[model samples]
Target chain A: MVKKEKDASTEQRILDAAKQVFVSKGMAGARMQDIADGAGINKAMLHYYFRSKEQLFEIIFRDSIGRFVPKVKALITSELSLYEKIEQFCDGYISMALENPYIPMFVLNELHKQPDAFVRKMFNNELPDLSKLVQQIDEEIKKGNIKPISPVQLIMNMMSLCVFPFLAKPIFSILMGLDELQFRNSIEQRKKAVPQFIMDSIKR
Target chain B: MVKKEKDASTEQRILDAAKQVFVSKGMAGARMQDIADGAGINKAMLHYYFRSKEQLFEIIFRDSIGRFVPKVKALITSELSLYEKIEQFCDGYISMALENPYIPMFVLNELHKQPDAFVRKMFNNELPDLSKLVQQIDEEIKKGNIKPISPVQLIMNMMSLCVFPFLAKPIFSILMGLDELQFRNSIEQRKKAVPQFIMDSIKR
Candidate 1:
């Protein structure tokens, strides 16, 4: 059991290192040697654990999705009122994006390269099922608590408003003439403002 | 004059081909040879037209900015009401993104690599001056035509909602269970829906 625990820890260390290298260099440009160097492991050990770069990348990509989707599921499934859910989701998602700014781009870039495989893998495994949330939105509309809007579009709006600013951070910062601190402040502002915007649009 | 016109035509041909290659392959993966072949020109002529792949890419990127921003300026500055502007902007931006589906990723990837240079160039050359739009928004707020909101935030929301689905097309499509036609239809839905959502949020 002790040996197994140590092996698991080492595997996680390798994964963490692989993520950094892969996110920066992308799949086509990433090298196993660099990942091994980042993890302070030898290439042979990397091969022993993951077999190949493609396998390692798949693991890393799945791990990335794991980090993002569970939080979404938790927030959407929680018993918070719809307004509160949007607020919490906006704050949580924006904070998450800020912390791991590269993951979205990494996922999107790989998806562009291998659309069928990545999309199937994500849909089958990591993308959260939002059926409950969709049903809840329908219920709310029926209750006359909110305006009629497609739940999918509403979710997409929340996501785009939360994520795209961070995704386009480099260009957006310069376009707005904002320094790093100001850019972050703008995001902080969105945490409250986005939910308010959505509530304003929806509340009957 | 005839010699100059021929040179200009060759230059344009090289640019058009380079945009195609660079947009599809990205900067790290694109080759001058591929671009030359696409243009139906020899490598020597390609070099004569644009000194290096880097120089050629910058031009292409700048040209891309040219295509998107002028339309933005035109829409924002036109004699349309604010509601009409939002509708037109959503329609125009989505159509532009569909037509050049790869440009956003190309621009974002290059911006990731050369943030300072790209940001400076965009700010200095291509970013539309939106002071008039901002003033109009403020005026609308003062006159109580819409709820009080920061013009910058409004612009950001409009951009995020309009651009992000296209930018994250592959993942979004799979996540939403949208095939190509369905995805296009969702965007078509947004042309009216987005402006209505915005109006609902802001209209007094």
Candidate 2:
């Protein structure tokens, strides 16, 4: 392989490894040596690639926000009606979360630890533009398509329904005596249940 | 004050300080010195009281579980009707969480870090007795009093709706440009909105 190709492969490996360590151990507990080991590279390569854990975490955090927010923006702003959007979001998000269970907690924990970086990445240019979704909800209310509820409250409900299960899975697993498959099965149940639940509450 | 009273005061102060530090900084980032400083006692007194950070954290963690689980147990297992239980849970849990914003994340994060401990404290007696509540939902469904739904799914929905906002508050605050009072007003909205949402979803 060419030297440039090898360099790209190594960089990708380092990022994947760093993301795993950061997600599992969190920002405070994760160590550079751990990331280097996970990546199958020496300390020198890890340092040469990212310089500091903060810099590497910034990359991962930025990438997570990039992957999550824009899709949400697109879905809400798309031509689909609000009910269709809710159904699609519930189905798609649960499936996505089942595959990438770490993202919800990792992003929230890191954001809790450091909000400034996330705000900078997500706040400007209406990149996320939640106001737009709020506006959409308002328009729906105007048409008497849904109950007269606060848009922000509706947004909060949609988010909580979709996101909370992923973070709370382990706790409930222990509480409910659920094995891994059982928990995932319950999550699968939400694919239909959540959308139905939301539509039931909001439909006029 | 007597020596016993004085010692008790210092211990209480230490516990309060440690709880705050653990909640804000998490298990990995919190320091003994910070707890000591916050408690207004030197490291020596702190050591005399708790011996080690692990011991101190264990006390605080167990205290938290003791305070939280028993109340929920009583509320759910009480003679209240299924619908009343949901309404009470939404109303009471939100109000409690609003007052003690730190506990949910702190218990969750610490539980994430060390499940063995939380499990040991909370696992038996069905001390929290979630199955009883699940059974209550099952009976309601059987009697055709409420729409058919999996008890587990319903529980997950209620938990998500009530808990996610506290963890996500800062991120949303920045996103929505909501100051503390406004954010609080939105939470107040949930006191009614969440109960209404949950009831609407489940009522036949």
Candidate 3:
């Protein structure tokens, strides 16, 4: 047998397989044996690269958080008006989620399971500083650009609108009897509709 | 040992234990033995009552859907204005969720796992008709009672705002560094704030 054990492609293949397994089954349900099978490697080899499932998840989660948090930081920190920010954020975030459909569930399920360790590791670098957004919202309220709403509440509202559908997509689709194409169409409409909904609610 | 089998209390006990096991571990990870232990019954007793985990989940799910869906149907079908409907929905739904925090995760997780069967059983009676709400929304738009918006979009928006908080509560609390009291307080404030937020956006 060819022993291409230490190669970059082999490592990438393992990561790809781990991402799929973790995304589908979540941390509690995932099995290392399944990951090894998905990666087409022996369990010994899977362990050789990553000591355990937790470690593998940490690496994958770090990669996901890195990509997700920075964009949010940039969106909030940019010198756009609150309305403009809402529009751009909804568009960017939804599009990002569409492209990487598994990330939200993967991060959230694990984060809920292990909040303290997950949050600490995710925010270790302090990349997406929320306080900056808070201050910006405060300035907007002071300037009469928007109605007085709690910055945290506004953040929560915006996030919940943009992300919840994806998080609960499978259930909503089945419950509402929406076929795949129809569900996607609603989301497509939401890119514009969500921003409008938020703006109308908050604009002075 | 005196056999006290096929009793009503024993059935209720098994049900309660099943709900807890299913909520925490989800269907894939839940075990029959755990439910038996939780109910303080032997495995044979549990099986004698429930036949299988799938059957147990079906019964529990039917009970959950019964309690939850009717309230929503009433909220929509009541002789209330759109504004009143939105207000009642946000307040009632939030309060319901706060009291039974486990149900959202329980239902959504199971529904996603088995979409077809779950939805079929949940709506077997053809309950909580969405069309009634959709018709009401159309009438409100015609009467200039609110801004023109798709009924489905509005329902999605309101639902996303109210329920996502509970669904993502544990993760949000940790991510935003909210303590228990703080999270509870936010939800408390949300009962009013969400309604106002929705009203402001759509009110003509």
Candidate 4:
């Protein structure tokens, strides 16, 4: 049991180190050696664990795609009203994005690079089932709670408002002439602002 | 004059081919040999026109950043009312993004890869002068044309709605169960939808 726990801990350490290296350097620039060094393990141990950089990258990529939209499916299907669900979703997602700013760009760029991998992952994994959300939207629209618009587009708009600020931080910061802290604070403001913006646009 | 004209044509051909290659493959994946082949020029002639791949990339990168926000400064300084300016800007920007869907991802990802290059380009190049735009927003707010909100946030929200869909296309497409044509159509729907969404949120 002790040995098994030690193995699991070591694997977790390697994963944590690999994520840091991958996030900073990207797939093209990242090296196995650097990941090993970051993990405080020898190259041989790294190889013994992951076999190849490609294997390691695939693991990370899958994990990233999976983690990017956690709780959205649950939140959408929850007992909350449409407005409450959207508020929670926007708030939760923006906060999550602030903590993991690299995930959006990293996942999207890698998807562009390797569509086949992403396609396979998508097929294998259970992504957010949007049909329920669509039904909810229909119910809300019928009940005159919100405007009639495509739920997909509405969700896309909300996600865009919440996430795009982080993805395009450099350009937005430069254009707005904001320093790092200022830019971060601006994004923090969007947690509330985005939900309100969406609700204003859609609410009846 | 014939010699100069021929040289100009050759350089233009090389640049066109290089843009195609670079836009598709990105800077790291691109090769001078492939670019030369695409241009139907020998490597020697490719070298004659551009000193190196790096030089070629810099030229394209600079041109891209400059072209991304062309006419923003001009539009802001134009005699149009704030509502008209925003309506035109949102319409024009969304249309442009739909046509050149790769621009947002390419610019933002490259900015992540090489901040120094992007910073120098942004500073040296004629990016949108936002001071005037902010002033215009203030004038409009005083006149009660739009609700009081940070001009920077308003601009960010506009851009986020227009561009983030393209940047996160892969994820959005998969999660929304949209194929390429469907995704493209949804984006087309947004050209009108986004402006209306913004107006609904901000307009008095």
Candidate 5:
């Protein structure tokens, strides 16, 4: 049991190092030597544990997507009102992204290279059905609580409002002439403001 | 002059081919040989024109950002009402991005790799001042025309709602079980609906 635990720790160390490097450099640019160096392990050990870079990347990508999906799913599945759910989603999505800002870019970048494989894996594994959230939007529309809009459009609007800030941070900061502190504070402010904005638009 | 025209066409071809390869593979993954093949030019000609992959990528990145910034600046500098500006921004941003869907992800992914460099280049070029938009938001708030919200937060929300859908297209398509037709329609719908949503929330 002690030996097994030690093996797991070493594997995790390799994964953490690979995640950092892969997220920054991506698949084709990342080298086995660099991952080995980052993990404080020898090249032979890296191959022994993961066998290949592709395998290691797949593991990390899966784990990253898995981490993001549940929080998003929680927002969709919650019993909160449509307004409350929008708030929860905006807050939760941004916070989750803040913790791992690189993951979205990493996933999207890799998927651009291997769309069929990544899309299949994502659908087969991580994403939850948003039909419930869609149903909620429809109900709201029917009740005349919100303007007439498709569930997909409404959900996409809510998501775009929440995620684009982080995705466009570089452009936003440069265009606005904000430094790191100001940029972060601006994001923090959005935590409350985005939900309210969404609620205002949709709530009758 | 004839020789100069030939040189210009060659440079244009390389840039166009490089944009396609770079946007798909990113900087780290793209190879000189691949770019040469894409451009239907020999590797020596590619070297003669651009010298290196980095040079080629810089040209593409600068051009892509330039294309986006002008429209954004126009929206900012316009004399339209706050609500009208949001509508125009949604229309302009989405249309530009759809015409070049790869650009937002390409700029964003590269920015993650070298944020300081991206910021410097972005700011060295023309960009819009948000003071006008900020003043508009402040006026709206003072009159209680909309909920009191920071203009920065409002901008972030507007961007998030507008941009995230394109950035997360694969994940969204998977989660929503949307076929390509449905997904395309959804985007088209948001081009109209997003502005209305933002207007509904903020209009008195």
Candidate 6:
């Protein structure tokens, strides 16, 4: 039992270190040696654990996507009003993103680099069904709780508001002349404020 | 005059090709040879026109940022009603982004790669001021024209909704199972619907 726990801990350490390197350097630029260095292991240990760079990246990427997609799916299916869902989504996504700001950019950059491979992999993975959320939006519109609008638009809007800040962090920080702490504080402020702003704009 | 016109045309061609390559491949992955190939020019001619890859990239990046900032500034300072301004901003931003689906991602990726350099260039270029927009939002709130909210939050939300789709095209396409046409149509729909959505949520 102890040995199993130790192996699990070491594997997690490699994953964490690999994620950091991959996020910063991207696939082409990241090196196994660097990941090994970051994980405080030798290259042989890295190979012993993950076998190859591609395998390691796939594991990290899938792990990152898994973390993000399930929460979004849960938001879609939750027993909340549309207004409440928007609020939940904004707060939840921003908070989650704050903890993993690099994930969106990392996923996006790789997707741009290898669209076919990334898309196929993502699709093969179980993703959230947005159709249910769409139906909910339609019902809300039909019931006169909100104005008529496509759920896709709402989803896009909600997601954009939630994710763009992290994706554009460097430019946003530069444009706003914010340091790391200041940038983080701004995002924290947006956590509550963005949802309120969205609700204010959309509620009947 | 003829020579000047020809030079202008060549420069425009180079810019267009550069935009396509840079947007698709990103800065690190993009090469001058590929850009020249895309433009149907020889490598020496490409260099003669733009001096270096960095110089060529700067032209496109600056031009893109210039196109984006002014329209947003107009949203803030225009004589339209608060609701009208919001609609106009959403419509304009979505339209522009959809047309150049790769611009946001390209700019964002480069910004991440070289934050300080990009930010300094943008700052030195005199980005649009949001002070007037802030004041306008304050006035709107005082008169109860819209829900009371921070202008910064409002602006960020507006931008986030408009920009995130293009930024996350790969993931969104996979998650939603949208082909290029469906994705394009969805954006077109957003152009018309986003303003109303925003108005519905915010207007008392």
Clashing pairs in 4: none
Quick one: ranking by TM-score, best first? Answer: 2, 5, 4, 3, 6, 1
How far out, in Å, is residue A127 in model 1? 4.0
Flag regions of model 3 displaced more than 4 Å: A1-21, A30-63, A125-127, B1-25, B29-65, B124-127
Predictions in order: chain A TM-score: 0.72, 0.80, 0.82, 0.76, 0.79, 0.81
User: How much lDDT does each candidate structure score?
Assistant: 0.80, 0.81, 0.81, 0.78, 0.78, 0.76
Q: If you superpose only chain B onto the true chain B, what TM-score does each candidate give? A: 0.73, 0.83, 0.80, 0.74, 0.83, 0.81
Give the Å shift of residue B193 in candidate 3: 1.7
- Ranked by lDDT, the better of candidates 2 and 3 is 2
True contacts kept of each: 0.54, 0.61, 0.61, 0.61, 0.85, 0.71
Considering the true interface contacts (CA pairs under 8 Å between chains A and B), give the fraction that model 6 also has: 0.71
Tens digit of per-residue lDDT, candidate 1, span A11-82: 888988888877766777678898889888889989898989889988877766666666777777777777
The worst-scoring run of ten residues by lDDT in candidate 5 chain A lies at A1-10
Between candidates 2 and 6, which one is better according to DockQ?
A: 2
Tens digits of per-residue lDDT for model 6, B1-204: 245664447667778888998887887778888888877887897888888888888888777776767666656667777777778887887777877777787767767766777656665666556677778889988898777776666666667777888877877787778898998998888776777666666666
DockQ top scorer: 2
The regions of model 6 sitting more than 4 angstroms off are A1-18, A29-52, A74-88, A177-182, A189-195, B1-15, B40-50, B67-85
Q: What would the per-residue lDDT of candidate 5 be over residues A31-71, giving only the tens digit for each residue?
A: 88888898898999988888788898888877777766666
TM-score of 4: 0.81
Report the candidate with higher lDDT, 1 versus 4.
1
Q: Rank the candidates by DockQ, best first.
A: 2, 5, 4, 6, 3, 1
Compare the candidates by lDDT and give the number of the best one. Answer: 2
Q: All models, DockQ values?
A: 0.45, 0.63, 0.48, 0.55, 0.59, 0.51
Query: Which clashing pairs does model 3 show?
Result: none
Candidate 1 vs candidate 3, TM-score winner? 3
Please give the clash total of every predicted structure, in order.
Answer: 0, 0, 0, 0, 4, 6
Give candidate 4's root-mean-square deviation (CA, Å): 4.3
